[model samples]
Target: MMRYLIALMCFFTLQNVYADMTLTIMDQDNKPVSDAVILLSKESVSTPDAVAIMDQIDESFVPRVLAIQKGQYVNFPNSDDIRHHVYSFSKPKAFEIKLYKGSEIPPIAFDKPGLVVLGCNIHDDMIGYIIVADNSYVIKTDKDGKASLPVKQGDIVTLWSERFIEGVNTTKEINITNDTEQTLSLELLPPIEIMDHSMGYGFGKKQW
Candidate 1:
């Protein structure tokens, strides 16, 4: 009898998660914008425990992006033979890890929900991002500029991007009961100036 009751509860929980939303984002010139982070907040936020990894490979932050729920942990592993220091100045989660090699350092826990801009002080060109979301409904747009997520109706919707200008509409409210699709226009700051392409990624023959 106890097993029967547990099975029924699980069924109802799964049924309530059918609220899915498909999102599309366009930049100032109406070009599909990738790497945009989507945040969904509910009156009660609950996410299964998760651990994310940001790998240091080829002198660059591989994947270049990551999303994790608030209070979760993130592992930054150096895949290259040389050492790399990872730090972020973003207000959401400002932290710095000393120069190190491999995953010997304990995984960092992102307690606050916010964006973390990662960089290697030694390797200026190596950059990455970590979006620590308060809610579990967090996902970044794909290279093709499309993504779908399961979000309950009446949840608050917020959008964030590194390219957003000082003054811009960065948040929006979303209501979805059934599967829905949306297209949005976003204003962004001017593109950043191109930087050097030959910067050492810590993997070259420099023999540090």
Candidate 2:
């Protein structure tokens, strides 16, 4: 039992020593864009514990954009008093949550990697986006368009956003080290028609 205890402690200590890295992303005209997904992976990483919540409040999705590892689940809860019939038609994974007053059922699992556009059959104006990534090490950029994570050294990381087509913008890779800090600048296309209706909420944009 003493040997087992020592090994367990060592395991936790190593887990806490994952390499620290910070990624900053920018768009054309040098503006910060939030909700961009950053994934660090040399190979596919599976995270069974990762789950995202795309809540509904005041007739709009609380989090308009989401990032999740493929095979992860997403729970859509209604905080408002009205019922919601949430559904998605995006091809990566498609399903519908029948009209419900609250999150009374289990979450819907996204088993494939693709963009899932969420909409409500009952509410025409409600829209949400669930970006299912192919790896487990995923983090979303904050209002400053930055994300900080402890990644393993040598992991290959990539940045992605909805503003660009998935093929060209997401293919570039960066290798991480023990103390790698980088500012990845990306120029995006001008705000399109869809951006007008998107749920735009910036999270913690501080002057640097």
Candidate 3:
């Protein structure tokens, strides 16, 4: 009889420990952005370990946007027939993945918190972003631009996206004391045009 009572108490305790919060991100036109990235952090929460980024065929970064905690490892694997040179010039960690063909090399560790822009020297069209955050409760938006955050009551959650300009968009803030649903709408300006310089590969010269 005592064992049965104890088991019931433990189950209820675990249930109360976990909470859920829903987040919705929308553009100015009220359309969901399927490719948005979501990040969550708390002041007292400990930073979690980092993750890796794998490079697959066609010289493209799988999961174009990735999120990791500070001081984590980002593995860059070249699963293609040709060689690849992966390098990042962001403020967090600047390093290069030399020309390689297989997964024999170790992963790169990013210890700082910043945005790491990745590009392949061999493939000019390949581009990726690595966002190293300081907390563990983070997730990427789904096709409907919706994400559920597992957070406790009174935790501050911040949202970030490359599409929204810093000064123009308003970031939605909320407290997760109960199951709540919130929508965020951002008005983004036109993206800055970058000069293309990929014509040197002998594919036919074109003006930038």
Give the alpha carbon lDDT tens digit for every residue of 1-208 in model 3: 9999999999976675554667777888787765466656553345555446555455666656787777778777676678989888776789988788776778877788767778899999887778777655667777688888766556667666657666313344544554456677777654323333233211122323
Q: Which runs of model 3 end up more than 4 angstroms from their true locations? A: 1-18, 43-51, 151-155, 166-179, 189-208
lDDT of each model, Cα atoms only?
0.72, 0.72, 0.67
- Cα deviation at 206, candidate 3, in Å, is 37
Q: What TM-score quantifies how close candidate 3 is to the native fold?
A: 0.70
* Candidate ordering by lDDT (highest first): 1, 2, 3
lDDT of 1 by residue, 1-208 (tens): 9999999999987777665677877878887777778776643456547667787877778657688888888888786888898998888778888999977778888888767789999999997888877765777887655678766555456777767775322445544544467767767765443333234442222433
The residue pairs found clashing in candidate 2 are: none
- Candidate 1 Cα deviation (angstroms), residue 151: 4.9
Q: List the residue pairs that clash in candidate 3.
A: 50-72, 52-75
What is candidate 2's lDDT per residue for 15-126, written digit by digit as tens? Answer: 6566466777788678877777777654456756956788776677767778888888887777667888989877898889888876666888888986788889989998
Task: Locate the minimum summed-lDDT window of 10 residues in model 3.
Answer: 199-208
In model 1, what is the error at residue 57, expressed in angstroms?
Answer: 2.0
**Model 2 scores what on Cα lDDT?**
0.72
- Please report how far candidate 1 places residue 3 from its true position, in Å: 30
What is the overall TM-score of model 2 with all chains considered together?
A: 0.67
